[model samples]
Each structure stands twice: as structure tokens, then as C-alpha cells.
Target: MRRRRGLTEEERELWSRVAASAQAMHPARPEMPAALTPPPREPVVAPKSLAKAFRVGEKARPRTGHDLAPPIGEGLAALPVVMDRKAHRNMVRGKLEPEAKLDLHGMTLAQAHPELIHFVLTAQDRGHRLILVITGKGKPGRDDDPVPQRMGVLRHQVPHWLRLPPLGAVVMQVTEAHLKHGGAGAYYIYLRRLR
Candidate 1:
């Protein structure tokens, strides 16, 4: 696959303006496609070398908890994945500073998904264990309409992306960050160690 490129400053500015104007116009929402019956699951290919190198244990499995968001659309959110107590404590206390960061401020889901996959893979390869991903809390539409508003789209989508297929292998945990780290607009990604 051709490498996905980050949006330039100019493109970002243009997109922001376009999105704003489009929302202002209050265009009719598109009709939803019919949902098909669920297909058989395909087995995910895990990188054995990396898993061995990371020495991941049973603790790496995603556990059930209150932190999970309910299933939405085609994406299913992982069950409130979390790190060990020490790591979680450090993160909450702002002691475990992120080793890397990714800002997904102006990108749509189409644009952000591939970029997200690439970023996580690269971070894992580089031995980064902690990453902060900023997905801007999306703008809320005018409330006069009877339809429910779509707000903070990525806030719901990012977690789903982290739990799907190949990308899920490298991501050990996903948590909402403190206000200093962007609050509801971002996530802390804990990656499996690299060899």
C-alpha cells in the first residue's frame, strides 16, 4: 500500500472551513445502507516475534469493565482496556509522559484510519510503549433540528479502530486521558514492546 501522508497546514485550514460551511448549510443526512448479516470471522495474524519479544502475559488481554463504550456501527469498542495499576497510576498522575504523540485534529474517518494504523505500527517498531493520540472533539451541529446531532465523531471511532484486526495486536490498552492530555478528545495508547 502507498504510504498515507499527513495533511498539510493549508489543507487542514481549507478542510476546517469547508466542514464549518457544510455544517452551517444543514445538508440532509444520507440514507443508511441496509445492514447485512454478519460474516464469518477471519483469524488475525499476530506478529509472533514481537509478541515473544514483548513477553506479553495474560494481563495483556482486554478485560471487561465500565470504561467500555457500547458497540457502534461496524466498529466494536474494546472492553475498557487498561494497563497495570502502576502504569495506570503513573498515567493518571501525569508521571508516565507519552513517548510519542499523534494529532488527528482535522482528518475525517476516511483519512484518519490509515494514518492511525501506520502510526501505531511505526511506534511499536520504534519501541515506543506510550503514545498520546489527539482526536479533536468534533463540532456539534445546530440543535434546532429533530435529528440527533453528530458530535465528537472520532471520540467514538478511535477506540473501535484500536480494537480491530492487525492494529489490535500491537495495542495493549486504550484509556481516556486527563484534561492536560486533551480530556475527551484524546486517548493514551499502550503498545506492546518491540524486539
Candidate 2:
């Protein structure tokens, strides 16, 4: 390496002047403007104001399938598990017939649990594509009852059970059964083929 040369007297003077000028221009900590100072309370944007600010353009794209919309009626018994459009269409049209079915209408959760597991496993072993499982819409409760009856326990619980481990692994889709197959009281469980 070559021997390094030190800065000239003029260069040293120039650097010192620049440093001094910079120090004079800025303080150690800047004094923020009152407008920029954080407020004690959390800031909130009004919904209407925010909506207007983000209002869609005149040429906005049409709503797609993913867009949120109100259900036609009271909505599905249980949200259908994920499936392609063609499979869903076929099932909805009642083209795919169930190979086996299990009705847990009058049975409690305990009674239904073992039956459901056994039925699904048996159907899967036999290579059944579609099967119906009826979980009756619970009885209507009196309007004047102090606490409303938790009707349709099976309707709600069955979907959750099908989504749990082992069951979820075998099940492809779980949709509300067609009117011919017990309507909202039942579900169509589409099972995956054995590997």
C-alpha cells in the first residue's frame, strides 16, 4: 500500500466550516410541529367519509362470485366445504346419487358420533362418492320461552365434526342435501377416493 497523505490546511478549514454550518442548521432533537404531535386519543376515520374517499370509479369491474351478497333465504344449513363448480353443480342438480346414508334425526350427539364415523369409514372403504347424512332441523321453540331452545344441535354439530381430523381427511365436500334427500334436514357428504 502507498503511504497516505494528510488533508491540506485549506481542506481541513473547509470541512470544519461545513460541520459548523450543519450543526447550526439542525438541533440534536427536532421540535415537532403541533399538527404532527401524536394525539392522546386514538384517531378514527368516519365510515361515510372513508367510503366516499375510496368510492369506486364509474368503470368499476362487475361483482365476481367472491363478492359478499345476502343469501336467497335463511342461508345454507352448513357452509358447503370447498369444491369445484362442476362437482357442486352436479350435486346441486341431484345428478350424483348417494351410495349410502345415515340418519341421526332422533339421536343425540353421543349416539350420532360413533354411527357417523363408522358410516363414513365404511362408505370410503367401499369407494362411495356421495352419501347423505340426515340431521333433522330441530323443533320450533315457544316464542314466550325465557331462554330460546337450542334447536337443530345436529345440523350445526355434524358439519363441525366432518371438518375435524380423520373425517376432514376423507371428506371432500359437505353440502346441504337436496329437497328429495331430506332438504335442509340432511347433508351430502362427498368422500375422497382411497389412495
Candidate 3:
């Protein structure tokens, strides 16, 4: 069995003095005061300059030029009246015949524009009343973006372009052909015969 050596009398007295000093130096901390609670926060208010800066009102004036016109007369002169889809349907539905068709299914906006203009002129020259243009419904190609060559590009743009000065005189009316002819992707162009 192992025996631990005992401290000398002087050493024991020194430890007792240290223990008393420690107890006196560090008395227990008192409970926190209730008055030390955080003060209530005040509501925020924006400065007058900032409030005035953010205020909005009606526009100064109405916009003018090509962009202001309806979709049918977008880049064209102001006609007496603009035809809506229903009115256009009535104008071209039974008037167009199958034999006068001009298929432009895969033609790009660039190719189609000039080709369409020329076709209208030629048709007018030949005294053809109804000419069908088949612009196929646009498909989302390689990048998932629409193929402008198909439906979206021409379907919306063609009517606007047809109403322009050069072709307006020759083109009596333009409307989406019936589903049997080609649906929304095709247009039945009715021409005013050359005088």
C-alpha cells in the first residue's frame, strides 16, 4: 500500500489564510435591476423630400407615331376604320377560292416580306380576287425559341406591313383563312384589281 506525505504545520496555516482571502474578495453577485430593461423603440418616419420624390401622376401627353397605332395599321397610314377579327372573317371567309393559293410555309420574315409584296402586286396585275398564303404554325426549333419563319413572325407582322402605302392601294383586305385552308397561320389576301 502507498502512503501520501502530510503537509507541515506552516504550510497548512498558509493554505487556510488563502482560502479566507478568496471568500472575502468574491462575494455573490446581486439580482439584476428591473430599471435596466431596454427602452421602447420609436416608429420610423420617412423625410418629406423622399416622400415627394416617390409620388407619381398621369403621363404628360399621349404617344404618337407608328407604335401608337393599332396592330393592323402599325406602320401604315390612318385608315377610315380598322377591322377586328370578326369583321375580317366576314370580309374574306367565302370570298377566297382554293385555286388562288400561294404557300409560304417555311419562308423567313425577310424572304416572306418582299415575296408577299411582290405576290400581291402580281395578283393585282392578274386581276386575282383571292390569294391564300400558307405560313405554317411556328415550331420551337433547336433553342426552344420560336421559329420566326413559321407562324409567330408573319402572322402578326404581315397585316401591319400590308396596310403600308405601296401595297395598301392594291390590297383590299387581309384575313386569317378558315381552318380548312390553313387556320390562323394562313392569310387570304383579297386584292383590288388594277385600274
Candidate 4:
């Protein structure tokens, strides 16, 4: 919820000095036959020009793969506001409440898909302006389970599913629910006006 601040300049300087003078308490050298031992080589150092600058307590290095997507909150926040400004603020702030709600907590992907489609379409037809979709944060697999299992299967998929046709055509805005609702596990769906 809250981020810890990075080290101050004085703290950084102190750390650098401490690190420079520090020696390993116990050096480790594997015992190996002379023939098996590799010859030592000069330590390679990056050219000052090529060295990268970093601050203390920075986030981890960027992930190597391009396949990963941003966090749900970040991705959703980046989307342009597609609904009224006042309503949008109210919805995000938990000031506005949904008229109907659907829970897809226990359903698998195959089962949750159709159920979601029906719920969204029905809500639109009923002239409901806002609704809540609760896809509980996924559960982890049992230790003894033969195959590895992924958790929060529904939490991630539901948003993507809402953007597809049969539902996307009727949906206007989709945002994370407030604490009063299900928080991360739930979403507040604002439906477009029915024609």
C-alpha cells in the first residue's frame, strides 16, 4: 500500500564506504583436483561510459520477456475515460453503487465465460446502468495436486472477456471495485445506454 523511500544521499555515501572496506567473513573455495581447476582470469569491468546509473531501493530490473502485461489497476487506469467525468470519479471513489451483481467465484474458465455473457446482456436489456461482477481472487492449488495450478484465474480473465463482443458491445466502463464491494476481486461495470 505504501512504498518505502529510497536511501538518502548521506545514507548512500555511508553504505558505499562500508561496502568498500568490508571483507567476506568466510571465503568459500571449492576443493578440486589441479587438472579440474580452471585458470583464473582478469576481472572484467564495464567501461565507465557503458556503466548504468541506478538509485538505491529502486524497483527490480525490468522483466526480460515482452509477453507480460502491466498490473490490472495500471492497465485499467491507462484507458481513456469513456463515461461521464463526475460519474467516473464517483464510481472509482465508491460513491456510486451497482444495481446488480454477479458472482463467478467457483466456476472454471469454460463455465464462467457463458455465464458472464448472459449476465451482461441481461443487465443491459433490463436497463441497468451499473453492475458489479465478482470474480474472487483465485485460490492456490493444494500441495499434493499432481499438476501445477494457477491462482486467480477468473480475476485476470474477466476484464479481457468483458472487452469482447456480445458483452463489449453493451459495456461502457469497467473499473475495480471499492473496499465496500470486493476490492480487487470485484469490478464495477458501467453499461452504455441501451438503444
Per-model TM-score on C-alpha atoms: 0.57, 0.56, 0.49, 0.61
Candidates ranked by lDDT, best first? 4, 2, 1, 3
Q: Which 10 consecutive positions of candidate 4 have the poorest summed lDDT?
A: 62-71
TM-score of 2: 0.56
Q: Which regions of candidate 2 fall more than 4 Å away from where they truly are?
A: 1-81, 141-145
Q: Count the backbone clashes (under 3 Å) in each candidate.
A: 0, 0, 0, 1
Clashing pairs for predicted structure model 1, backbone only: none
Tens-digit per-residue lDDT, 10-94, candidate 2: 9999999998877455557978999999879977777664444455587788532231333211344346547777988888777
* lDDT for each candidate structure: 0.78, 0.79, 0.65, 0.87
Candidate 3 off by > 4 Å: 1-99, 141-151
Residue pairs with colliding backbones in model 2 are none
lDDT of 4 by residue, 60-90 (tens): 7853322145668677888999999999999
lDDT of 1 by residue, 41-66 (tens): 99999866744445547558652223
Candidate closer to the true structure by lDDT (higher is better), 2 or 4: 4
* Quality of model 3 by C-alpha lDDT: 0.65
Q: Which candidate is the best by TM-score?
A: 4
List model 3 lDDT by residue over 1-195, tens digit each: 899999999999999999887745677789768898678899899766744444355545542212223443232224332445464555445533644766676778898889888887887777786788777665633443343222255666777677896888777766666777777677777676577
Worst 10 residues of 1 by lDDT: 67-76
Model 1 TM-score, all chains together: 0.57
